[model samples]
Target: MTTKRIIPCLDMTEGKVVKGIQFVSFRDAGDPVQLAKQYSDNEADELVFLDITATVKNRPILLNVVAKTAKEVNIPFSVGGGIRSVSDMQLILRAGADKVSVNTGAVTNPALITECANAFGSQCVVLSLDAKKVAPNRWNAFINGGTLDSGLSAVDWAKEAVRRGAGEILLTSIDMDGTKKGFNLELTRTVSRAVSVPVIASGGAGSMQDFADVFQTGEADAALAASLFHFGDLSIPELKRYLSEQNISIRRDV
Candidate 1:
């Protein structure tokens, strides 16, 4: 059985790691490089560094910050935000990102996904979807740090992203983010069922049971969280042990 992955996400803005509720009310977490090293040493399966402000500011991802963070950890890391073109993807991968995640950029120019996949292989291309519930039965896409609405349905956009050559989907529920309630299982299951590629569920991870629920109920390939890992409320090793005890397949440090 393939072990389900546990990933820690670092939301970076102006070079500092931060976290917030529903993608707002930001609070400083710590230095990106330092926090990343700690997570890596503590047995985090992977790390995601997001330049949260770059896209909102209409700027390129800060490579200097990525370089600094990458230097501190040995685990595979992914970088996203303000990544607009193939050249931008190249720069990030060269900076030590094993994968490059694109959200707003892919929405604006979907061909960018195909371009990066062709140049760097689909495995290196990740499509990060920021989605929010707009009505009882509808969820719309948001971009530029959840400040602008794309007016696209989550299901439709996810299918389009996969068709355009995304190897994986990093689906985050803007409604559930930082709520610590649990993952948006319906949304995750919807996307995972819609796409052939692996779907990673992010946002709203409050406890160990939430992780297990996401994998079992959401059918997510991986579960990613920020605050739960950031504040030491849940350590990766302990979380994995808990998952194993529950008989949920998970990668354990040998």
Candidate 2:
């Protein structure tokens, strides 16, 4: 069986890691590099660094921050936000990102996914989709830090993104983000089944059982969380040990 992955996300804004409730009421977490190093030491399977405001601000990703954080950890890391073109992706990868995640940029120019994948290989490109339940049966894609609704259904967009060459999908539920209630498993399963590439479920992870739930349902290839890991609510080593004991495949810390 494929071992489940536990990834900690550093939502970066103004050079610091921050967390918010349902994407608002932001509070400082800590230095991204310091937290990243800690996760690395604790055996996190992977790391994600998102420049949360770059896209809304119409600025490029903070490559210096990426470089510094990448230098602190040996594990593979993916960086996202304000990535608009193949050149933008090139700059990010050169700055030490193992993969570049595109959101608003890809929404505005779907072809950018193909361009980046063609130039850098699909394995190096990720499509990060911020989705919110707009109606009982519909989830609309949001962009620019979840401030603007793209009016696109999440399922349709995931399929299109994969068809356009995104190697993986990072689907986050805006409503569930930071709530820690649990992931929107329905959304994760829908998107995962809609696309062939690996799907990393994000938002609303509150406990180790939540992680197990996501994988057990086959709704996500990996579970990514922030507050639970950032606030000492959960430790990577302890979480992995618990998962292993539950017969869930995970990479245990050496």
Candidate 3:
């Protein structure tokens, strides 16, 4: 089996890293650059910086912050929010994001995904779907940071995104986000199994067993959480060690 990845997420707003529950009730976490460096120093597998309010604010990503944060970490970094066009992706890539994630933009004009993948290669395009359960065993994609429902099936969109050249899928469960109850295993497994590309499961990570359950049962390629890691609930090394003890393959070396 491939090593299960543990990714630390930084949800950005107004140039600072923030964490919110269910995509609301925002709280300050820390400076994005400092947090990025700390995670890198601790051997985090990867880091994701999301401009959570970018879409709602209708502004471009904070390139200055992205550039500064990229310099602090050597690991792969992905940036999202306010990314609407190929030029936007170019700027972000030039600024140092290893990958660019899009949701509303890609959904509005899926051609953006093809254009980005064509311009920067599929490995650079990550389609982030903010999904929420609407009916029995059914979930719809949300855009603009869980504010608007796209009415698209999470599973169907994931498949189409992959077909359109998205190399990865960042699946965030809006209902489960920041709940720490556990990952939406049903939602995660459905999307993961539907897409050929790796799916990073986000939201509802409460404990190490939660991580294990997502990896083993949810079939997620990578599991991402914020508050648990940002609040000192668990360190990356500590989590990795626990996962290793559970016989889950994981990267030990930074």
lDDT of 1 by residue, 104-160 (tens): 999999899999999999999999999999998688889988878999998899999
Taken over the whole model, the C-alpha lDDT of each candidate is: 0.87, 0.86, 0.88
lDDT of 2: 0.86
Q: Rank the candidates by lDDT, best first.
A: 3, 1, 2
Better of 2 and 3 by lDDT: 3
Distance from true position, residue 67, model 1, in Å? 2.4
Error of 3 at 7 (Å): 0.8
Clash count of each predicted structure? 0, 0, 0
- The model with the greatest lDDT is 3
Least accurate 10 contiguous residues by lDDT in model 3:
20-29
Residue 35 Cα positional deviation in candidate 1, in Å, after optimal superposition? 1.3
